[model samples]
Target: MLRPVTRYADDLSYVHHTGFADLARGAARFVVDLIGPERRRVVDLGCGSGIVLRALTDAGHEAIGVDLSPAMLALAKRTAPRARLLQGSLYRVPLPSTDLILAIGEPLNYLEPDARPPALAAFFRKVARALPRGGRFLFDVIVDAPGRPLSRRAWAAGEDWAVLVDTTEDAARTRLTRDVTSFVRRGRRWRRTRELHHVRVLRTVDLRRLLRDAGFAVRVRTSYGEHPLAERRRAFLCTKR
Candidate 1:
């Protein structure tokens, strides 16, 4: 079993094209619209590098970020010194009272099936205890489709890198497994990395049901509106009742 590798800011500059700005905008709009006057305190769940949290704070909203990757958090501190960053997993968030909560960039898609209920329950419990009535809990994930090709073969074009990855789905076990191998050439040194990610694939209906059970009502489901690049994932916006 392989675990996901953590990427630092320097690494992110080379890997992610938009970096964090694209994610920040989407989350900011959702939180501002949902929390209205109460959007003072925003929690960025799975806040890799605190990009969204930083954006929210710059816009005058207080922000807190939680992530499992310490390497990423280190970079986040340099960029968003005003926001509080905590080292923690999405399944367990430590906070009290938030105007809005966000888990963007397909973090929730990484949970396994049996683990999802508990994770979602934990998220809901934390948000419920921290947020007042009518607060918002928003998240997004890549809709799972079995036997789908994620990319082509591994290849490098100049300094840019690309690879093909896929996830294995076990219907009987309700389990989804992700595997990847990527390599980047730095000067004369060739750096290669591989990771194994195990996630759960909840049906659309089942996901909604879990949210409802967690004390939220469906607000909207928006297809990512970014430059055709985000067409690969689905975004779900839910609100606490």
Candidate 2:
């Protein structure tokens, strides 16, 4: 079930401030701790709205963000005016050599199952070519939770906006389909937007193997913070070998 990669267009607006600021800030702090306060250049792959980029710049580090959504990039530019923002995909983007590379927010999961390995290999090769030895890469993936039923969730922000998400898992529970619908207040009217996202869930062992084959020394943790299992997201810290 290989589907063409879909870009987030109108859906970007719905997620710009989707209540994940705390998590983004936490991830940023963890990154700073790992890299120290040397003010190194950092590139955030799939950096939606520049949340982490803002944190990086505020910490006195040079930061750049790359994302596939122009709408998201626009918001990012406005939010993190100090950081450079680019519109592009993770697979092929012109990026400078950096001290650290971030691909958080389950970016890799967006790829289809068959595309994950080759795409990840190319991603690692690009990072390797764009970084010096010992450079670090940090990313996260959503691990499959078997026996979890189809989940429906909703969010509302006063009278300004509302979102509904319905998630359906494949029989094998290795793939997820997310159907999102958003309603935003505009003047006296409410506008609606809808998007469908497909994602693949990868086990920790699979992720470690990918990183190892890509020439990295990898470490996996349940969370980036001091807590071991605060969230379902698993973080991968890799150093170029």
Candidate 3:
């Protein structure tokens, strides 16, 4: 159940491979610390470029990476040659029995508002069936802030490529729209690509409720590491009860 990638997928993968390795490394470390030396099989949902999977494998765990974008999967294959990689949609991807399932990098944000609950429920059911009683699921979500001002951001990769992102929220603030434009150097010429993305925002209470209904005992942290205040991005650690 794979879907076609957005126009920005190629440039996004390129940027991730070139500059985002440290972010992935930090996430991997956080995950490792949280789970300890269990030596359990790990599955990384929406595993772009297999950075986390690579780290897990290096730490002596059997790791598998799953993603929908072919461009991302290609980079993952190159970056983590020894790790197993699969390309498919999260909703229908068949995964092996695992001790930990990771859905990082804003994968859930991509679902529409109405589809979020059902999709999460289905995902939880699948994980419940695939994992043992003490298995764990770790994920992060972006908290919604109503009336947030629109903003535009940009990033560059030396002289080869650049990406511009314009973000705006819906009137009700339940959905966020991002218009992205990428400029890439192609030999003597430059190529421009544009893509529009719509993401839904979820409340912490609703997310906790959904996980509870799906048979998990959930704990949330404002940040992955120690922090004094809650941040927009929150992480959820769920264990099968």
For lDDT, the strongest prediction is 2
lDDT of 2 by residue, 13-38 (tens): 54545544555777887887887878
Model 3 residue 19 lDDT score: 65
Q: Write the per-residue lDDT of candidate 3 for residues 89-152, one digit (tens) a residue.
A: 7768887888999987677777532334336667777877777888899887766643344444
Off by over 4 Å in 1: 1-14, 17-25, 29-39, 112-118, 144-164, 170-174, 185-188, 224-232
Q: What is the C-alpha lDDT of each candidate?
A: 0.62, 0.75, 0.74
Give the deviation of candidate 3 from the true structure as CA RMSD. 3.8
The CA root-mean-square deviation of candidate 1, after full C-alpha superposition on the true structure, stands at 4.2
lDDT of 2: 0.75
> In terms of TM-score, which candidate is stronger, 1 or 2?
2
Q: Write the per-residue lDDT of candidate 1 for residues 1-241, one digit (tens) a residue.
A: 5444333234443343333356656665655555565348888887776677767777778888887767668767976889989986766656767777788776776653233334565566666667777777777765543445344333333454543346555655355565655555677876766655666554566667777887778744654343222533556666777
Residue 193's C-alpha lDDT in candidate 2?
76
Candidate 3 lDDT: 0.74
Quick one: how many clashes does candidate 1 have? 2
* Model 3, C-alpha of 128: deviation from truth (Å): 2.2
Q: Cα deviation in Å at residue 161, candidate 2?
A: 1.0
